[model samples]
Target: MDVLGQLVAVPTVNPPGESYGEMVEVLHSIMEDAGYEVSAVEVPRDYLERYIPQHADHPRYVVIARVGSGRPVIHFNSHYDVVPPGEGWSRDPFRLSVEGDLVYGRGVVDMKGGMAAAILAAQAAAMAGAGDFGTVELSFTPDEETGGETGVKYMVEAGLVSPDYVVVPEASGSGNVWIGNKGNLWAEVEVRGRQAHGSTPWLGLNAFDGMARLAVALSEELNSMLSSRRSSYPFADPREAAPTVTLGGAVSGGAKVNVVPGRYSFTVDRRLIPEEGLEEAERELREALERASAPLRSAGYSVELRVTSRSPPSVIDPRGRLASALSDAVREVTGSPPRLTVCPGGLDTRYFQLAGVEALTYGPGDDSYAHAADERNSVSEMMTVARVYALLISSLLSCPGGPPRSTSS
Candidate 1:
């Protein structure tokens, strides 16, 4: 708990780069003392020199510690970075406070808790003389928040992680196993119109008015489209089953109230299903927006759409051996079957899945606390996760050929 509390106290915020250097050093020392060979992978120099030093280097600093060397290697991956603490808090956001069973601090639940649990589990196994069936490796990378193109993406691209099966201790709450995640596409639409005095609105094209029309059309079309295409993950509430389209932000061109806005811009957030590729989704949205903006264009306005971020949707078979192994681990340790759910948002899981590695996200902590001030994790839950991870690694090692076991029906 003290170790975890120390990790929580270290602010590893991503935007301006947190004190990852300090956190990494601490983690390294912990693993080394536990009898594991540790190495530090540096972030790219160019990325370090930039304003965003953490991202500037595109660093893939992985602290790798192995117990044995061979096939059937089980790799545990987690990011050391976290999102900035958002508003609302009753105590110091960076300080880890223990009130009863809960540990309150930023990143405690988001991930640091999980990382701590994994480390402890490995340490326990080592102490017990649990001979490695194959190598057991833990990779602690930086930059998970902000979707910065550094951390895991760089590792995979650089051939750093080629484990047969990967487990990312992402926040999946207590009674859940994340089999997959929804894809996301973010795009900005800009409308150009002629500005005119508010008194003579007829003489000028109102960009805001044009944007308003587009928004309404998009809302109607998206509601119908998303509703008609409902799909459910075992963990998601059936009532909320469906892809969604949301207007995230909007900006008007004209500054003064008396002036008719000449330009307008709005951002869209689209969640996709596994069947749809990002390119296909983007094309469909562009077509819909273009059609809606056509009327405004005919009235002497122009509309443009640009994609900001496109993440492909990913899913793994819930019945697969990998899923079953994790499910059973949760059941054996927690004494309750875990709900298999699809993450409503995207995460690094997609990156692993795309690389053809069987992977899943499972960890203890209330995900609802992520990014919020006063984020926290339950001590009981963290300890339980540690025990669960130990069992999971043991089970995997015991199985012949180290293949994943089948899930219970």
Candidate 2:
């Protein structure tokens, strides 16, 4: 509780990306005492300038610590960064409030709480002793709220830390272990038209009107395809059984109300299940854009397509040894096997999975409160997660001889 309180008190907000050094220092001191080698993987400022301009110059850090060495290495990845507290908060977003079994704060539920739990688990394991052949590592990132481009992405690409198995513990689902996450493709399309005075609208072609037509046609085509296709994966809720398409996060066009716009554009967010191919889906979207804008193309205007970012969907087989160990730990301590499910939205686990490092997402708290005000987590659940982590690490790291002794809390 004291460790969690200290973490919650620090306002490590991401948009502006500040105050990471303070938190890293605190983590190093505690981790070193637990008999782990602690270090920081700094994201170069120049790299951030070209990749994530929003975070340019702001120091980005990935805090890493490990105990033991070699063979079956188990890594725990979590982000300490929290989204900006929007509104309607009952109290200060940085202040850690403990009421009975709950701990309230902004990042507590989103991720910092998970980080604290991993630390507790690693500390316990060290005190108990981890034999040769098993190594435990904890990696805390600084930019999960911003898509982890400069945090986890940078760490993995920079060859900072690579383990045989990874557990994100990203506040996935309350009692379920998340083995997969939905994939996404973000893009923008621009339509060009001649600008002219509103009084003589006939003199100029209206780009906004042309773009609206394309949007309608594309929406119809995407929706029609989505209806016929459903994911093979099982979801607890049957309602969300198909892919999704969302257009015009914010449509911008036209100069003034009186002026006929010369150019119009809109952003699109398309999500695909693990069964779909990312490249194929993107090609379909692009081809559809071209086909729908054909009528406007003949009128002497043009259409431009730019892909913002895209990531393939990630999934893990529950039959794998890593998952089986985690499941066994859950059953040993909690007396019930944890369900394996897929996350409805994207998270950082995709980075590790993409790197070919086996990864799973499991953590405490209701995921619904992630970006919401008055976000909190149950202290009991956090401790439970810690126990599971310790047990899993011990079980996976113990010699290949006899079954390891129980580390159940």
Candidate 3:
């Protein structure tokens, strides 16, 4: 817990990911000291400059440490990056502060805690000569909080994640093993209108009014249309169901209070179900925007919709070998079976799934604490997660043959 606390104290916030380099150095030192072969790979400078300008020079390093050899490589993946510590903290967000049983810090619960546990667990396994059957790899990445385009996505694209099975130490609390996650599409809607003095309101078209009408129409359409179909995951709550549409930001063209706005813009965040791929979801959203703009078009207002980000949903076989192995490991370590659930939000698992790997999200800490002020994780929960991960790798290697054919993408 002390070493883990030290890691949680180093705030590697994304966009800049300032502490990524430092964290990689620490991981390298630890892995090397533990008698494991280690290496680091920096994301290309040109790519970083183009996509992540804020962290253009900051290296998004991957520290890979291996133990044992041969087939059935079990990869433990976790990101070192964390969301920016927002307002409201009782103590310093960068420093891990323990009050009784809970350890509080910005990234403690969201993921640093899980990463620390994974590393320590691997070290423990190495000491116990537990890597006898096959190999164990640890990949600590950066930029996971911002959709992982520069982190695991880059690695997977480069063929750095060719593993028999992958386990991401995400904040899945303690009881749930995340089997899938929803996709996301972010878009911006712009409305153009004619501006005139407020006194002659009839002579001028109000962009604000046009946006308001569009918002209402789109909101109603999303609530009635998108929320009708619920997910079939057994762990999903019936009342807390379905994909959702959220209106994020809205901007009006008017600078003065007395003028009729000429231009308005708004952003939409659409969470898609597994049945709808990224392209299909975007097409549906485009149709909705077009339908919503019809009223404005009739009233002589121009509307345009542009997509910002599109990510696909992912689902791994819940009853497959990888899932069963992880479940048995969790039960052996914690004395209880794990429940499979769908993550309501997006994560790097989408990238692994796209890369054709049998991957799942499992780790400590509650999802509700993610990105929240004074984020924290239970020390005992992290210990349990470490044991579960170690046991899962061991069980997978000991099983006859390797991962079941069904898990092979």
Q: What's the lDDT for all of these models?
A: 0.79, 0.84, 0.82
Q: What lDDT does model 3 reach?
A: 0.82
Compare candidates 1 and 2 on lDDT and give the better one.
Answer: 2
Question: Which 10 consecutive residues of model 3 have the lowest summed lDDT?
Answer: 400-409
lDDT of 2 by residue, 139-202 (tens): 8887888778888888898988867789997886446898888898999989999999999999
lDDT tens readout by residue for model 3, 31-91: 8877678889988988787777776877778778888776577888888888888899889
**RMSD (Å) per prediction:** 4.1, 3.5, 2.9
| Weakest 10 consecutive residues of candidate 2 by summed lDDT | 400-409
Provide TM-scores for the models.
Answer: 0.91, 0.93, 0.93
Error of 1 at 342 (Å): 1.0
Measured with C-alpha atoms, the lDDT of residue 191 in candidate 3 is 86
Task: List pairs with backbone clashes in candidate 1.
Answer: 41-61, 43-59, 44-57, 47-56, 47-57, 48-56, 48-57
lDDT for residue 317 in candidate 1, whole number 0-100:
85
Ranking by lDDT: 2, 3, 1
What is candidate 2's CA lDDT for residue 137?
Answer: 85
